[model samples]
Structure formats: structure tokens, C-alpha cells
Target: MSSLRLVPGTPDAVLSALTAVLDGRGTPFAPVPADPAAAARVRQAAAPDEPLEHDCAVVLTTSGSSGEPKGVLLSRDALIASATATHDRLGGPGQWLLPMKPYFVGGLQILTRSVVAGLAPVVAGDSFTEAARRLTGPRRYTAMVPTQLARYLDTDLDALRSFDAIIIGGAATPAPLKARSAEAGVTAIPAYGMTETGSGCVYAGEPLDGTSVALDDGRILIKGTTLFSGYRLRPELTAEVLRDGWFRTQDRGEFMDGRLRVIGRVDDVVISGGVNVTLPTVQARLLEHPRVKDAVVLGVPDTEWGTRVVAFVIGDPGRDELRDHVAETLPRTWAPRAVIRLDALPMLASGKIDRQRLLEELR
Candidate 1:
């Protein structure tokens, strides 16, 4: 049996090691996270066993926003398929920008796609916006989560528009952000997928070629050539998610005009006074307020209402005004009972909002 390889280094070194594995020259690698605890969690979960699949090429660590980190096993064929389909969907292979860390699947895909295209991806150092300004290419592309994109909206419109395509994932891209990108003539694509489905099998609410998407009672189920084999060292967790060739996502989705629309996570719903409140819908309404830059709605324990809908907002909107805003769009009970003001939401290294951390803050 081949030994499991652990790689630790800067972004460039990580990309280089990932490329070597993709090129069938190096040992299967598990990219290390910057956080010591996260890195150790990945290493613990990535320990090799006799039942491990021989074809595994990469072991990716999930962001663990919802739970414990699990190493996702990606075979060579799956990685290739994901890269091929992404290029095919985006017109063709081109130069890429590495604005995020290479440990996550999104950043790793940038390296893999660049290797397949025989192009060197531009690595951002210290200042991503500055690096983006210096890049010169005919067909340039990059992938970033909403947090990174949010930081560049006003000052980097020109830099953003320079790219042929900007792939946005890791979290839900707000409607306002999408509008701003469209108005600026930036070809921004919102992707929906997790570490389990390679990088992203669905772009802009549409499944890519060679990928199948369906809604099973509001939960999103995806099956594709790019799907990971399974979770490393967690057969029970893998069995719970992957069944009958379909990966059951925690997110809820809907179909409209033959396109998929992500509704939110199944765990995002909470009962308030015997009525189900969807956090995403409430958060969307909160974002509609001009003063509110970003918002995360969650259910906090309340003895009176079972679970009261509470919102963490990043703007200066008044409690009454924000409550009235939600009440206008949704039922009164759905409005957040309380609003907690934050300068900025805590973010994971992957640029996703740290929901678990926010819950801890409440406790």
C-alpha cells in the first residue's frame, strides 16, 4: 500500500505539489490548513487504512463550518473530469488567478485547471487587489468567495471586469453583489457545490455537463463524474451522505424552468411559535436594507418561543427598522426578535461565514 503524503508550505508550493500529484508523479497528498487545529484535524482524519481506495489522488479538508472536519477523497479521474467540465463550461482553458488559499477545493481547482491548461496561475501575495491589477492576459479567470469579492467591490471594479470569468462560491452570493458585478460587466458565476463534489458541479444554478442534479424533498442531491469517492476514515459519515450513487447535500433547493435554485440549508430552518422560519429568506430581506452590508440570521434558544429568530447584522440599521423590514416581506413571527450589530461577520479561511462560531458567541 502506498503511504499517505502530507504537504505543508506556501500557496505556490502547495499548488506545485498538487500539480505533481495530478500529473501522476507524486504521492497522494492532503493539503494542510493554516490553522494548527484545522491542520491537525485533517491529518487525524486522513490516516490511511487498509480499506482506502487505491485510486485516490487527493485528500481535501472541508471548511468544517457545520461540524468536524473530514478529509474528502478525490480520485484522479474525478479531478480531471471536474477540470475538463469547468473549462468546457467557461468557453476554454485560460490563465487563472489564485486569490484564495490552496488548501480548500476552490483554490486547489485553480491549480489543477491551470496545470491541465498548461498555464501558470497568478498567485496573489500580500495584496490580492494589487496582484490582480498587475495581471495581464487575454483570457484571465479567478475564483473567490463572497467575502473576498465583497472587499473588492468598490475599488476593484476595473480589476474584476478584466477577467474573462470570476467564479464565486463557498457561500451564497448576495443578490446585490450579483447586480453590482453585472452592472460592472464582470462575468461572475455563482457556483454551488461542496468538497464532496470536486469543486463545483453546478454554476449559476445550472448543473454542468456530466453532472446530474435533483431535489429530494427540498434537499439537494447531486451525482456526477466529478463526485468524490468518499470521506476518509469516516465510513459512517460517508454512508449517511452518499447513498445509491447520490450525494445528499445539507442544502435545500428548488427547480424552476429546468434550472436549480438553492433554497438554503435543511438545518437553517427553526420553529418559532410553532411556525417554521427559514433563515436565508430572513437574511435576504435584511440585506435589502441599504444600510445593511451583510447579515446572518439564526435561531437562538428562547424559552418563550422555543427558538427565536435572531439576526447578526453588519450595518447600523435600527432594531425596529430592521424588524419592520422583515415583517414587510415575511410573516411577523419570522422577523428577528433581536438584532446584534457586528462590524464584520467571522469568516473561515475559505471565506465562508463562520456559523458555528456565531452560535458560540450567542452561548
Candidate 2:
């Protein structure tokens, strides 16, 4: 029986524990946040008394956006496979800049890649520019969400461009943001993957080496060495998603020009006014508006429409104007019927919109 340890989820602590686990010198551990509530949840999920399976390296939890977060178990082999594939895609790893919290897959993979490269990662401390200066590698890489890129572009263009490539995941990169990154010569690569795939296996719409992607009725199915072993203590849940060598993902995707184009989540589509509407389409249209900086579109339960299309927006855009803007490209019924303007969207610690919080506002 493999013992599980609950390591404190600090960059140094988690990194140290992870290093030991990867080196086969320590017990299988779960990194728990220092925050009381979050730590409790992680501890409960990990359940250290329950022995882990063979070769389990580290266990990480999901963002728990929809509901209860599940613990994802990853073996040392899977972690090494992911790091090797990432290095192959990124012109061989030199050194990584750790900008995100270490507990999440994106940040964890940065450390993993650095380990595989036999190079120490430069943690992007309070100052990104200072951290960029410390990257002594021939090839530099970092991972961040869309929000961080926008902020860095506004303040530190040179530092942002210092890296050979920047991996953007955890959320959709707005079209405007993508254009800005390109214009700034930032070499931002949009990645698509989740905790299940052990971080991103696809970058810039291309699957990395040792990773295979297929579509099942428009749903994205991934099969590769980068896949996680199973959900810790959740056998039934593991069997539900992992079939054969393929792991089923909930995101909808399409092959466009021989590249995997992730449309959105499977549940992003909702029937409003008896017409099916994809919320991301409406969200994208709102983002294209000059006056709108950001937007989140959601379908809410309503008596009249069965499901009402609602939008939470940032920037100074009028509800009617935004609705008309969406209608210009999409069907009139697909446009958000209700629009709530906000100064800024609430974000999770993982750099994703707190969508469940947005739904709470409706209640």
C-alpha cells in the first residue's frame, strides 16, 4: 500500500514534495492549500489513511467550478511523459518561469518540465520584469491565463517577449487578446487541456507528441501518455471517463484546417426561446464590441424562456447595444436577453471566472 501525505500547498513546499515524489524518494502526497476551508476539502478528498495505487506521484484537485472538486491522481510516468512531450513541442525545455500557484496543473507542469530539463525554474515573483531578467536559459517558457497576458502586455511588453513561448490556458483567450499578443510579438500559444490530461497536451491547436486527439459527436476525446491515472478514491468516476486508452473530456471541439478547435464546453449550449444557443458565441460577440472589455454569457432557468440567455459584462456598453451587436452575427433569439454590467468579473484563484458565483447572483 502506497502512503499518501498532505503537503502544504506552497510553491517551495509543494515543489520540494513533488521533487521527492518524482525522484521516488518520498511518499505519494496531495498538496493542500494553507487556507482552512480549502485544505479541509483537499484532505478529505486525499484521505491519507487510504493507501494509493502503484507509482502514484502526486494528486491534484480540479478547480471545482461546477461542483465538488475531484482529486486527480497522476503517476510519475504520466508526469514525465507530459514534460517530455512539452519539451519536444517547445524546441526543448531550457528553463521555466513559474507565474502561477504551484498546486494547479499548469504551474505543476512548469516545475515538472524544469525538472526534466535539469534546470531550475525562476519563480515570477511580485515583479515579472525582475523574474524575466533571471531566466538564464537559452530557451525560456512560462504558462499563464489570458488575464495575466493582458496585464503584462499593458505594462511589460519587453519582459513578456523575453520568453520563447508563453502557454495560455485555464480559460478562453479573447480574439482581441490574441491579436494583441501577436501584434506585440509575444509568441503566446493558446493551450487546451484540463487536470485530467495532466495539463495541456494541445498547444496552438496542435496536439503535442505522444498525444492523440479525436472527436466523439463533437466532444473532444484525448488519448496519450500525458493522461492521468485516475481520480483518487473515486473509482466509479474514473471508470466513467476513462475508457480503453482514451479519456473523454466534456469540452466540444472540431477539426479546423487540420487543427483541433475547441468550441466550448458541451453544456455551454442551451435552448432559449425554443432555439439552441451556444453561450460562448454570444460571449465572443460581446467581447468583439469596442466598448466591452470582457463578458460572460450564461443560460439561466426561466419560466418564460425555459432557459434565458443572460450576460455579465465589463466596460461601459449598453444592454440594448450589446444585444444588437450579438444579433448582427448570430440569431436574434441567441442574443442575451438580460445584461448586467460590472466593473470587473470575479475570478477564481486559478485565474478562471467564478461562474458559480455569477449564477448565485441570479438567485
Candidate 3:
């Protein structure tokens, strides 16, 4: 067994070590190796005299949800705990297919799990069929964002069901997509978590083994052994989010039927006439409509009410009829005051709804 440690070093060293490991070559395991003579330097320079921890093995970059990247320190134990929990939840680890890049935390988790599970992950290229063929045997797993899942749905159902379970994360999966996936015999688990929580603490709709979830001031708080130590060199930020050993995620969620349902970012909510409106909830409901293929909701400036709830939908339907359809099921206030029909909804590179871009287009 190789002992891992965190050492203060440069990106070249870190990359070299990663390359070595990926190529089956051995390298020193340290959180930050201080010696310039070491095989490789850390990705980020470390202070020579700074206090360094030896147990941390993985350094994850924040998702930049709040517009700035932060480094998350993770110990080997934490990463293993997360992978083990996922394996247990999925009923044993098998072959994994990576349709996404490994530089991301989600992708890294898949690669790490493959290594931990003693299996090599198949990287999908131009051929989806080739990827499906690699997923041989009884158990198979893959991780994809909602957009990828949607795109896969547009492809072949047989290829989509090739996996035993597909963990969907990186964004809120609309209810319609989840339903369609189940109908297609694909086990699509909508995951909720951030880099601070070591990928996803909640899977399907429940917290993984040993992970605890609670709400503090409408913000979801997660506490678990898998939680990252803190943002690297940003004590103020780390203190702001981490309190009482719980990571305060910006996301707001509710617990229903013993499962967690993430509503949206707390800031994503808009208040109109003193009524709080969750954009994601409205979009989710809109997606439930038979004609709507995709939907995104945002708040637009309104003179009468502080902000008006506006929705951009990708589908063909009369605005009144769609409004009535939404009003019939959801609360009247939750219904979008204005529906902007669009050929398609804007998406981020991570496959999330680009609300900022949509708002710009609407304006």
C-alpha cells in the first residue's frame, strides 16, 4: 500500500506525479512535497515555511458557483469513504465509462472509484457504441450531467440502458427527464453535492451512508467524514461556509418522504409582492408539461412588483394554455407571469441552465 501525504510544491510536480500514477509509474505520495528535488512539483506553489499536512491526498477546485475558484483539501480517507459509499449504494462496483473529462471533480470521482474498485474506466470518444461495448458484465456504472442524459435519450435507448446505473449530477435534473430515464430502464440518480462535500453526499434523493444533511437559515448544510478540510489558504471563506463542522452550501433544499429535494440556490429565488418564488421549481413544473422539452425561469425587473417571474421555454404551445396548465397544478404565484418561447434554452458548459445568459437575452 502507498502512503499518501500533502506537501507544499508546484503544478509541474503534481502533474508529473499524476502522469506517473496514470502511467503506472510510482511517485512520492504527499499533500505538498517541499523539496525542490522531488520527482514533481505541486500544481500550485506552496509556502516553504507554511504548516503542511501529510494526510491530504486530493486537492479539488471549487465549482466557482459564487464566481471565484477555491481549493478544497481532501484526505485519501475522505475520498475512499465517498467511493465506498457510492459502491455500497450501487450494490457493488463494476466497469465505469467516462463520457466526460476527468479534470472535473465528478469525472475525477468516477476515475478514483474505478481505481478503488480495481477496474479500469472506459473513456467514451466519438463512438457511443464503443463505449457501450466496453461496459461488459452484470454491473456497470457511469456519471453524467442532465444535459448528457438528455442527449443520450436522443440517441439510442439501448445504449443508454447499457449501464446498471447512471449517476446524474452537475445540475438539477428536471422531473420529466428522471421519469423518461426510468421508463427507458435506466437507473438515473439525481445527485446533490459540491466539491466541498467530496462530489455528492446525496444520491437519488437520500444522503449516502454516514452523511448527514440539514438546513440552516434555508441553506443546505452537510456534515460528513467525506467533507473537505476547507478552502485552501482562504480561512475567511472557509469560516464563512464551514461552521459547527457542517459545510453550509448555498443551495436550499427540503426534506420530504425521508429524501432531500434541492429547490435551487437561495439567491436564485426572487421575491415579488413579498412572495418568494423559486425559479427552479417553476422550471421543473414547466418541464412536466407534455409539450415542453426544456424550461428556464428568471426574475425580471417589474415596476409594480419588485420583480416579475418570467419563464423561457423550449416548446410549441400557446402561452395562455401553458400558463393555465401550470396554474392548474402549481400555486398561482408559482406560475410564470410571462412565458418567453424560445427554440432552445441556453446551457452552461457544465450542462446547467445558464440563467444569467437567459436573463440577458430576455432583457
How far is 339's C-alpha from truth in model 1 (Å)?
A: 0.4
Candidate 2's C-alpha runs over 4 A off are none
Worst window of 10 by summed lDDT in candidate 3: 39-48
Q: Scored by CA lDDT, what does every candidate get?
A: 0.86, 0.89, 0.73
- Which residues of candidate 3, in runs, are more than 4 Å off? 1-55
Q: RMSD, model 3, all Cα superposed?
A: 6.1
TM-score of each: 0.96, 0.98, 0.82
TM-score of 1: 0.96
lDDT for each residue of candidate 2 in 252-323, tens digit (9 for 90 to 100): 999999999989999999998889999998899899999888889999999999999999998887888988
- Tell me how many clashing residue pairs each candidate has: 0, 0, 18
What C-alpha root-mean-square deviation, in Å, does candidate 1 show against the real structure? 1.6
219-270: candidate 3 lDDT, tens digit per residue? 8999998888766567788789889988888888888998888878878888
Pairs clashing within candidate 2: none
At residue 82, give the lDDT of candidate 3: 87
Give the per-residue lDDT digits (tens) of candidate 1, residues 1-363.
Answer: 566777873577777787888888877878877688887877787874434654688888888888877889999889999989999999999888998888889998988898888888889877767888766655789999988887877767778878899999999999998987888788999999888999988999889889999888899999989999888877788899989999999999999888898889998999999999999999999999999999999888899999989899999998999999989979988999989898889998888888888887777
Error of 3 at 88 (Å): 1.2
Best by TM-score: 2
